[model samples]
Target: MSKRFSKIAAGIMMMAILVAITFTPVKAQDDNQNADLWQVYETTFKSAKYVDLTHAFSPTIAVWPGFGNATFRATTAGADLPGYINEGETYTYADHGFIATAYELPTDQYGTQLDPPGHWNEYGATISDLPATYAIRPLVVVDVHEQVAADPGYHATVADIEAWEAEHGRIPEGSVVMIRSDWHKRWSEVERFNQKPFPGVSLPALQFLHLERNILFHGHEPLDTDTTPTLEGEYWLLHNNYAQAEGVANLDQVPEAGALVAIGFAKPEGGTGGYARYIAICPPDWPNGVSVVEVPGAPLPVQPYPLRRDENGVLRPTPPES
Candidate 1:
């Protein structure tokens, strides 16, 4: 038989072993479990679909300037290339094929990552300090794709936020307002991803979202809160003010509103930021429908929208102080 055929056969044999080893866990039922509770748990998400808003982490994934790359090195494999197995050991027929990989996780902020308050402020909240419930909250996507397509160095201004509110009805409090710049499409190649200056939140726009609207956090398709050109010595936007999710993808697929976003990641101690699994849990009948009126549990009182709306039903900006 040809060497290629032998390698394929070895791969199939190894896969079968891996499948058996990765069986689902069988956890015991809870003490106060009712049949309805079990049924509800089982059926609640039976028809739900999630949108992957995260970039797959890899050595090929785009890296921020002055950062390292994530890598995975196969330690052992079915193919008899170099050191497939022990020098004298031969392939086994049973489900015990030895295979492993050595990995470099890059920095915590590699690929798609979330920046908590502490990333900027010395005494600010870390990933662990953030409330567990904040992981899953409302999503408000404001598309700036067209504007950025026209001008590579665009900065989403306060007018952009106001315009979004005009249609979406005053971005409700505790929402994660994402600036959809469609930047992720170029993430495969570092050169293309960094080709232009890229868009970012203008100071007033950020102040509107964080201070006036009281959102949970802000997010973007780009790698940082500040535009590439403006990401200079002092990271003003990221320092101790707004939490952020950077290098996110697929925002173009998710709707502008009426969706719940779930961000999952391991909370590393003293972490500035880390890779996150960003998911958009949209309504089953979304795009055709609107945002949920109220979140199930007593609408999270994180930061209720304090500003009032205008005669046109838009959120009026906080008046400039004398």
Candidate 2:
């Protein structure tokens, strides 16, 4: 009987030890999980405000050269008097009788032929049509417009990035660095946006971002990242050097940093540059990695309209002249 009691006591003691060991790890794991959750929450709740970088889209909106102008007008009448019935006299109508009314809404104009084509032949869509799969990457905004305007000699050179890094910290790896010249500021006037002389990324800048930094992609708000007049340096960077090798344009929608961008493609199948819904994903805090996918501020790309004047003292698009 004593022996039996000893065996039972030992079994009970072993069970208690096992329970204590198991419970401690479970408690520790719970504590770790709670800590992670708190970190995410704090990061999210802090970064609530988002800066809008995209210019508004409208017929009056400024566009680059070659792109069409925007236009809108009523296309159909909403109500009309009946031909068979008099207006003053009421006529009895049978049950199930029907009346028709027509109304028209204005169509949105994209731009002219001089405008940048919506899609590239290789990508099969415009920069806007980038898929959700691409959204996971980090976004970097390179002030190409401001930088170039400030210093015409400025190129995306090592010195330029080093200067920027000195001010903003290291450029995060595997991120998209957008060049913002506030070039979109010209959206309201075509000549101002496209014709205005301004310096763009120099070849050095292109090489630095592409080969040296191995940036995922580079984009600019301007029609092209390089300067106009087709300088040999610029040509070598884009066509000859193909430094961008693979990059995008019109990155005005992305924030300088701490933003996730998703480009929704039109999926035109075998077409160059399909229309896209450009979206920005910002975290709640500055940089904790929780994203709030925001809707795009710009309208979808479309064709341009003819210019016209409206009765309300507004400039509008008229039918194109033959």
Candidate 3:
């Protein structure tokens, strides 16, 4: 057999292993045992915690306006596989036969999905072209629940971001910012979450983060970044140069700062955005100081940032340092 084939077989075997590995974070067993506030926080925080930020997708889950519903079908089951044996009233499959399925996904935009530049720019970076590091970053939450509660179409403005900085300090240089409007609470019901009017980051907010703060990524509770298209008109902020997470939820569980988020998704070649699973990792206790502060306190070190899409819309990432 060819060396390549042998290596492939070995790799597959390693992935097929079903070893169970569980990691338990540090946590206080008893809080009422005469512990102080810090002690309680410490014990609770000692072990790290994780929160699921991805929305669950299903036939009943909400979809973008005018989009089609997802349909799942099992192509082949144990009884249908070749070499199957039939008993008196039951059926058994050969050891090699197993359940098989196929998906005719119309687009990857359904459910919780990533929005790489390719989603907008024809020559933009595709999912495969994105660096692995992009998936992980410090998590920052901007809560606009007050305004959202007042107005369903309230757009997060520059003032909102400035307020966040006022309390938490300037957003970290490479943090993944999430906008929360408490919309995730309506996830169980489709229309309430997807069809009803919602709030999201405004153009000015996106500009401040992308141009000035230089955040690693941005996310929102709604299906789209530009929620008020009639007033905002055209999703230039998302389509022009930035990649964001859409249909994200559970921001209420995350804090204003100090958490870390990791996004995992499949990379389908020649595809746009697709289903994704994003998780936020929270340390037992919030850090003593702000999660990240640079502008007023200290200047951030220079790091390679991807240059804006060229005139032709092709992304040109910076070269690695020597």
**Which model scores highest in lDDT?**
1
Instruction: Write model 3 residue lDDT over 1-322, tens digit each, in one string.
Output: 3454344334323322311111122243242333444443343323446678887675557777677666544343434434553322232134433433334565778888888778777877777777888766778899998899999878788898888888666788888888888877777877677764777778888888888999987888778776664534125654665678888888888767656787898888866786889888665343222222212325655547744333333334556567
Q: Which ten residues in a row have the lowest lDDT in candidate 3?
A: 16-25
Q: Estimate the lDDT of model 1.
A: 0.67
Model 1 per-residue lDDT tens digits across residues 74-106: 443445455445543433334245434456775
Question: Which candidate do you rate higher for lDDT, 2 or 3?
Answer: 3
lDDT of 2 at 72: 43
- The residue-by-residue lDDT of candidate 2 on 199-240, one tens digit each, is 456667767776777675555555445554655443444343
Q: Order the candidate numbers by lDDT, best to worst.
A: 1, 3, 2
TM-score of 3: 0.67
Per-model CA lDDT versus the true structure: 0.67, 0.46, 0.67
The lDDT of model 2 is 0.46
Q: Which runs of model 2 end up more than 4 angstroms from their true locations?
A: 1-47, 70-131, 144-156, 167-170, 231-256, 274-322
